[model samples]
Every structure is written in structure tokens, then in C-alpha cells.
Target chain A: MQILFINNDGGGFADQIKIPDGTTVSDLFAQRMPGRNASHYLIRVNRQPVASDAVLQPGDRVSFTPTRIEGA
Target chain B: MRSASRALLRLAGKIHSRVESLQPTCSDLLLPDADWSRCRAAGRRLEKAERRGWRLAAVRLRRELRQAMEQLRLEMHRIEDRLTASERPPRIASLREILDDLRFLPDSFDEVRWDLRQEMLSVTTEPIVLEGFPLGRFTISLDWTRIGFTRPYHVLAREPNPAASDEAVTHPHVLNGKLCEGRGAVSLRAALESGRLVDFFTIVDRILHTYHRGSPHSPLSEWGGVCCPGCGDRLSEDDLTPCERCESVLCLGCLSGCPACRGLFCASCLEPCAECRVRTCRSCLSSGAGCGSADGSECFDGVEPCEGGRAQNRDSEADTHALLPV
Candidate 1:
């Protein structure tokens, strides 16, 4: 499955990424952010907030925004 | 017989003529002297009636005015009483008395300064350990003048957690990084009146414990989590929305998104479209069809212009440069 991911970091970037079916939000976060804490970032799907355990579907628009942007 | 009837009819005619001659003629009644006398009698009666009516009206008006004045006087007296009551200063302990009470504090507090200008007593306590967390040097300010029967003596921490970033942690009831304990003025007054430094220290200790524990009781906690600025409801993190422009964290109720650009905004920062009633940000308003008119008559269509929208537009224009990059 493919999803559109919007990352509001460093000039803001949006890209489509392929993920395995039934991938949870936490799995995606761990894959993208590596060792960073999940609580430090706000994750949203389709412009709406979603839980870490929420399963992702194809074509879902997800956004990852840091809770506090540095130097903001 | 016929001659007798004729004589009778002649006599009746003479009597009628005599009666008519006794009555005054229309021309005679028209004379000024006669008319004036009649008019004066009627005028007196009318004048009497008018005077009586005016007197009655005046009496009623005076009564109403007197009642109003009495009410106003009573209101003024009530307000004056309240003013006197509130303006009466609370009984406060003198500087010497406060310093004497400071003897109760432990020897850990090394330095003390009485700021006469600010009416505050500043104290520096040595580094303390609470729950395995080493609290660096802490400065406490106790305001004497502000402490009394009703007013709460404020206890503030000047340097809270010297080693940690100020933004890294949030302390409940702490304003501007100062620890403010107690529910309200009454509780605080009681604590201050106790004149025990241990009581004050306990509050500081609790603040530090709560900070280290990362579970300070927030007023918004009762509402399930942080309160939404828009609806005043408690919401969890999952239900929150961050404003793209102001970065304000708000709940769905207090947040609106532009349908065109999908940019989230706080309720106060978003403007409703004059046509569809959908909320839109200023950027969307300029670029999209948010400002379109329904019938090509006016940009606002037939809907009344929202005061918030107008004020927001004016404010946005004033800060356009700062807001544009966001």
C-alpha cells in the first residue's frame, strides 16, 4: 500500500511512500524517525489526528509534525 | 261666533309679537360687552379645570422623581459601602515580625534579602535532594505586604531547576517559572498566617516532587486533558489540532480548516466565507473563491458581515508581513 506523507520539517516536504498492508502508525513512525520518541511528534492522518495503533490504508494522507519546531 | 274667533286669533298674534320683541336680537348679542361677560364665565371654568389637571400631573411627576432620587441615593450608598469594605487594607505583619518568623526555616537557606521597594523577602536555599533528583540552588521570595487575612502571601521560586531547559518541563500552578501553591487566597492566607517556614517549605517540596514526577495536577486534567481554547472542553492529544499560522494547540471544536488549502486555524483566526459560511484563512481568501459573491451584487452576499471576520481581516493586514511566511 502507498500513502502520502507530509513532514513539516525543514522547508516542509511531502512525498508518497510504499508501506506494507496492515502497517500501524507506530511502525511507520519507528521506520521513518528511527530512535526518536513518538511523544515528541504529532502524527495525523487525512489532516485528522490518529492513534499510534491506528492501521493505515492505501491513499491515506499522513502528516508528521514535531511538537515544537526548533528555533520557532 | 266667527267674529269672536277672529278677535281671539288677533289677540294671540299680538301676544306672540310682544314676546318676540322682548327677546334680544342677534346683533345685540354680538356686542363686545355682552360677549365678553359670557366668555369670561366660561374661560374661568376652563382655566380652573386646566389648572387642576396640571397640578395633578405635577404632583405625580414630583412623586416619581422623588422615588427615583431615593433609589439612586440608596444605590450610591450601597456602592460606597462596598468601596469602603474592599479598600480597607488587610492586617499585615511588619518586616521585623516576618524576619523573626524566618528563624523557623532550616539552615539550608543561607542568604536573605529584604527588598523594601518590592515589599518582598528573598531567600536562597542550598541545593536539596528530593526523590533522587538533585534540585540546584533555589531562590524563594516571600512578600509580606501582600500577606494578610484575605490576601495570600505569594511564595515564588526565582531560579527553578538551574540545570534543565526552562521549556523542557511544565509545572502546574507555576506562573512564569515561579511555584504558586494553594487553591486560592483563603488557603494561602491560612498558610501564611501560620507563620511557619516549614509549611512554606512543604509547598515548595511538593512542587519539586510534582515536577520531578511529571504528574503535576493541572486544572485542565479534570476535563480529561488540556482544554480547548474554542469550546472549553477537555480533550486528549489525539483530538487536538495545531493552528498552522499561530501554532496554537486547539481541539476540533475550537479549530477550523480552510476547505481550499486544508490549513488549520484557531477559531479566532479563521474567517467564514460570505457565501458558503465555510471558514477560510486569509491566504485562502486571496487565492481561492472564499470571497466570491453569490449573485455578483456584493462580496458578502446577503449575509450580515461578521464582526470577528472584519476585525480579523484588519488585524491580519496589520501583521501581514509576520503572518505571510507561516
Candidate 2:
């Protein structure tokens, strides 16, 4: 299934990507942002906050925004 | 309520059009990105510069860090904080998506607003009280129409609570109305370029909500303090002295006392009297002190022209032009 993934972290970008039908929000986050703790990001599916185990559907808009972007 | 929602949708559309109309400039924003990177790198270098227990290298690196910050400031002045989606913004958000982003904001964000005519989208963050210091709420406004490759935003202090040491610095990472996005710049650009309005605002809000001790424009501990311009020492407001003449507040050690009036004044406000050569404030000498002779300015000292004064007081420039060997 294809899902729109928006990663609002370093050099933020959004692009449609192919994820397996069973990919959970946590799985996608681990795959895309390796070594990064999911606790730091506000993960949303279809513009609403979602649980880590929530399964993403095709055409779903998913975004991962850092909850604390460091300021100078 | 319908009207308000429609207005918001229109505001979102204005941003959509602006983001859509951007022409990627020939120049890449990498200049500032590089500058920003250098700044961060410079910060890190200081910590590692003296790992071998040598101090000279740390000093040199500190100077380099200052230079990098200066360059970043200069480059920031040159570039518009806009987007740069090379070939064109990818998959510009539809009006509905933009509206959805707007609607989704109220849940986590304090407030959302915009000006259709001004083409601006704004988010008012909840009061940012960092480390027990209330810096007041900030308004993060995005000039969506100015959207280029990066987000064009400015943060305004709604209640105007400024740093005690520097009024212009309302927040540690913010100077005046602009934010020193620092490490957040790249992510903000990415979100803006992709028309992820929600992400863009949230990222900025996160930046405001968070603080970096090493990269602050000004620290919060000094929020209630002042820096003495004379000695360059940080001091409380009561510890400073106000110059009697110029009214510039400075530490007492840097001030000079006038000989005649016996009053304290800044060094610049005291001039040496012509007669006794005493450093005197302007009020001590009569207004007519320098207005006596034919030159109108030569008659100094508020006294009768002395014997030596007559010799140098000759007004005749006649026969004085003996051309010397040049």
C-alpha cells in the first residue's frame, strides 16, 4: 500500500512511499528514522494523533514532527 | 462560524498560491545552511579543541566561532527566508488539505489566525515560561506569500516581556522579531517547501518551547540584569551609575570627575579648559570662554587675554606665506 509520509525532522520532506499493508506507525518510523526515539516525535495519521501500533492504510497521510526542535 | 471557516480557507489558499508561484532562485539557500552548520560546528569544536589539555587552540576556535556567527548574520540579511523547491514545489497541498491543517492546529496549538489581504498565517503559542522565567507568549507569523524554498516567519512577543539584559531579545533564540532557527532551519524549510503547514508551525512552536543553553542569543538568567557598557561587566540595574551630563548609565569606575564643578560625568562629556587645562564639564565654563578675540573662537578662558595670547592673536596673515620645501 502507498502512504504519504512526511518527516518533519532534519531536512524535512514529504513524499508518497510504498509500505507493506501491515506496517504500523512505529514500524514506518523505525524504518525511516533509524536510531531515533519515537517519543521525540508527534506522529499523526490523517492529521490526527495516532497510537504507535496504529496500522496505516493506503492513501493515508502520515506525518512525524519533532516535539522539541532545538532553538538557538 | 461558517464565515470564519471560509476566511481561514481563503487564507490557506493565499498561502497555497504564494507557495505555488515561487520561482526557485538561481542561488541555493545552502549559503545560510552552511553558515548555520558552521556555527553549530564551531560550538562543538570548542568542546573538543582542548581535549589534549592545550588552551591556545580553544582561543583560536572561539575567534573563528565569532566570525562564523557574523557571517551567518550577514548572509541572513542577504537572503529572504523563503522556500526553494528546485523544480517546483512537489505536490502542492490542495485547498482542502491546507484547510484541514488549519483545523487540526487548534487541538495542540494555542490559537491560529491569518490575514487574507496580507497573506499571512499566524500561530500564537501558549505562554512560554522557560526555567521559571515568563517570557510571555509569542506570535509566530508566516508570510505565506513570501514562501520560496523555506518558510518566511517572524516571532512577536504579544506581551512584550523582554530579557532584562537586552530588551530586543524577547527569547533566547529570538532577537527582535526574528528567530535564530539554528538547527531547526532545514526542517522548517522542508516542511514549508512541501506545503506541510501543520508541520511547519508545529516545528516552530517546538523550537520556541525548547531552549538550547549553548546556542541562545541571550540567556534567561540574565533576563533581569543589565550589562555595564563602561566595564563590560554584567550587573543589576541598581549597581550602575547614570552619567550626570549624558545620562548614559555606566559603572562608576569608568567615569571621570570634573575638576571645577566636582561632579561626575562620562569621559566624553568633559573637555580640558583652555586656561588651566583642567578637565571641566561644559557648565563650569562661561559661555563666552571661547569668544573673546577677533577670531571670535580664539578668545578662550573667560579671562583677560594674557601676555602670550597677544603674540599668537595677530589676525594679519599677510607676509606669512613662505613656501617651504614640500
Candidate 3:
């Protein structure tokens, strides 16, 4: 299955990447963001906040936007 | 009920048209800043390896260095040619992607509105508290026409729960509704140029939620207090003072005392003496208006003390002393 991932942190790109059919939201985050704490990001599926273990679906639009970005 | 739905749809349609109108500029706007620092670093590393290889004078080591250099050379060549182009959404794809972003998360997003008369696109955020300081809700209003010119957006505090010290500053980076942007400048610009409404709003919201102690306009810890603008030390309103002349808020430590009158004033309130060149308050300067020495020294008219004694009282030493600042 392939899903559109919008990583609003570094690079700020929207990329389509293949994922396992049964991959959960946390699984996808772990693969793409490796080592970064999941709690630091506001993970959403199709524009709605979702549980960490929510199962991914093909053609899903997932965005991981950080809740806190410092301003000087 | 149906009429309200129709009105919302109409407003959304108008916003969609506004986004579509940006197609001509997107091509230029989406071009990311080129970063060649890594490529230069790689070249420097290769040079270091080559120098070490020459020092060893080992044939095997030299061969390994040559292979490494060759690989680096190829990579540099590609960079030189700029072969690694980032993926830019095609005009059609960008249109679709951005339209979705504009209307997406309506349930979660407090309000995404367009004021037709003002030509402003605004997104209201939920009340945001940072470091236990309630900054209140903010409206990130973007004037699309000014997007590339001036910083197009103003983050206005809706409820105006400003820091106690400075009413003009609502957030660490926001002063009088204008955001300093800081590190978020590039991404905010990119999102606006690409018509990514959600991303634009998301970045603004994040900035509101986060507070960096070192870089704040006024730190949240001092939200209920004020700081001396000159020295940046936290001080109570009673302890702090203002520049008498310009009314600049400052701490006592930064006060300047007039040499003549011994009265405290700010830099702007003090004038240099014409003779001594010492800064003095206006009342103490020798301006020739007040009684003083003939050469204008010791004049309280805010000018330098003249060496010559006052013409009216050269012999009368008592009067000369009387003109002197107490």
C-alpha cells in the first residue's frame, strides 16, 4: 500500500511512500522519523488526529506536524 | 440551515479561486534556496584524505584515496551540474493538493476566513498557552497581495492577553500583531507561495505554542511583569523608570546623570555642553539665555561652561557662585 506522507518538520515535503498493508500509524512514524519521539509531533490521518496504533489505509494522507516550533 | 451551508461553500469556492490565481507565481515561488555547504565540506574532506595519502607514500593507501577522490569528484560533478532537482508538484497536482489543504480540517480548524473587503485571509487558532502563560487565541491574517513584498501576515491576539510588562507584545516573536517569523520565515514563505493553506496555518500555530526563553520579546516567566528595555533585567513597575525626555522604559542602572544639574535623564534627554562637551540636561546647559559667564561657561542654558566669568558679575564672586548648579 502507498500513502501520501506530509512531513511538516525538516524539508517540509509531501512524498508518497510504500507501506505494508497492515502498518499502523506508529509504525509509519517509526520508519520515516526514526529515533524522534512520536509525542513531539501531531500525527493526523486525512486531516483528523488519530491514535498511534491506527491502521494505515492505501491512499491515506498522513501528516506529522510538530506542535511546538520555537520563535525568536 | 441549508443556506448557511451554501454560504460556506460559496466562501470556500472564492478562496479556491484565490489559490488558483497563484498558479503563475508558484513556479518561481516553489524554487527552494540552493544549499552547497555540504558539497564544499565534502571537497575539503577529500583534500585532507589526499594529503594524508601523500604523507604515507603507500601505493595501496594512494589507490584507496584515488578511488575515494574519484567517487567524490563524480558526486561534485553532479552537484556542479545541479542534477539533483527536488520534486516540484506539477501545476495540476499543486492545484489539487492545495485546494484540499485550503478546505481540509474544517472541523478541527477554528476558522479559516476571507474578508472580501480587506482582501485578507485569516485563520483563527484555539486558545494557546505557552510555558503556563496564556497568550490567548490569535488570528493569522494574510494579505495575499503583499505576500512577497512585505511580510504579508499579522498574528493578532484575538483576546489580547498580552504580557503584563508590554501590552504591544502578545507573543515572544509578535509585537503589535506583527510576527518576527524568526526561523519560520522560509517555510512560511514557501507555504504561502505554494498555496498550502494548512501548512501556513500549522506553522503559525506552532510558533504560538512554543516559547524559547532566550529569544523571546518578553519571556513567559516575565509575562506578568515588565523588563527594563535598556538592560533587560526584570523589574517591578515601581522600580523601573522611563527616560524623562523620550519616555523610554528603562531600569535605574541605565540612567544617565547630568554633570551640571546632577539630575538623572536618559541619553536622549541630555545635551552636550558647548564648552566642556559634557552631556547635561537642557536646564543646566549654557545657552546664553540663562545668567552665566560672558564666554558662556557656567551657563545653565545647557551648553559648555565658558572660561570667562559672567560679564555682569566678574568682580562680584558671590553672584558667580550663585549661578553655579547646586
The candidate maximizing TM-score is 2
lDDT by residue (B1-326, candidate 2, tens digit) is: 99997788777777777767755453555456888999899988987987766465687688679867865774553343334334334566777788788888888678877777776778899999888888888999988766763447899999877866577889888898988776677667766765778888888888888876655666666676778898887664545777788988887787877644567888888776575455667765554332223332243445444322333354322224334344
In the predicted model 1, the residue pairs found to clash are none
Per-model DockQ:
0.01, 0.53, 0.39
B210-293 in candidate 1: lDDT tens per residue?
Answer: 331122223223223556777776555446767887878888767766655667788767776765576677776765445433
**Candidate numbers sorted by TM-score from highest down:** 2, 3, 1
In candidate 2, the residue pairs with backbone N, CA or C atoms under 3 Å apart (3 or more residues apart, or in different chains) clash, namely: A72-B215, B82-B149, B82-B150, B83-B148, B83-B149, B83-B150, B84-B148, B84-B149, B164-B223
Cα deviation of B96 in candidate 2 (Å)?
1.7
Which runs of model 1 end up more than 4 angstroms from their true locations?
Answer: A1-72, B1-106, B116-119, B125-138, B149-152, B155-170, B176-180, B183-188, B211-326
All candidates: TM-score of chain A: 0.90, 0.95, 0.94
lDDT score, candidate 1: 0.49
Worst 10 residues of 1 chain B by lDDT: B22-31
Per-residue C-alpha lDDT of model 3 across residues A1-72, encoded as one tens digit per residue: 898887776435566889988999999999999999999998989878899989999999898887776565
Which of candidates 1 and 3 reaches a greater DockQ?
Answer: 3
At residue B200, what lDDT does model 3 achieve? 74
lDDT of each residue in A4-58, candidate 1, tens digit only: 6654432133457899999999999999878888886658776457999999999
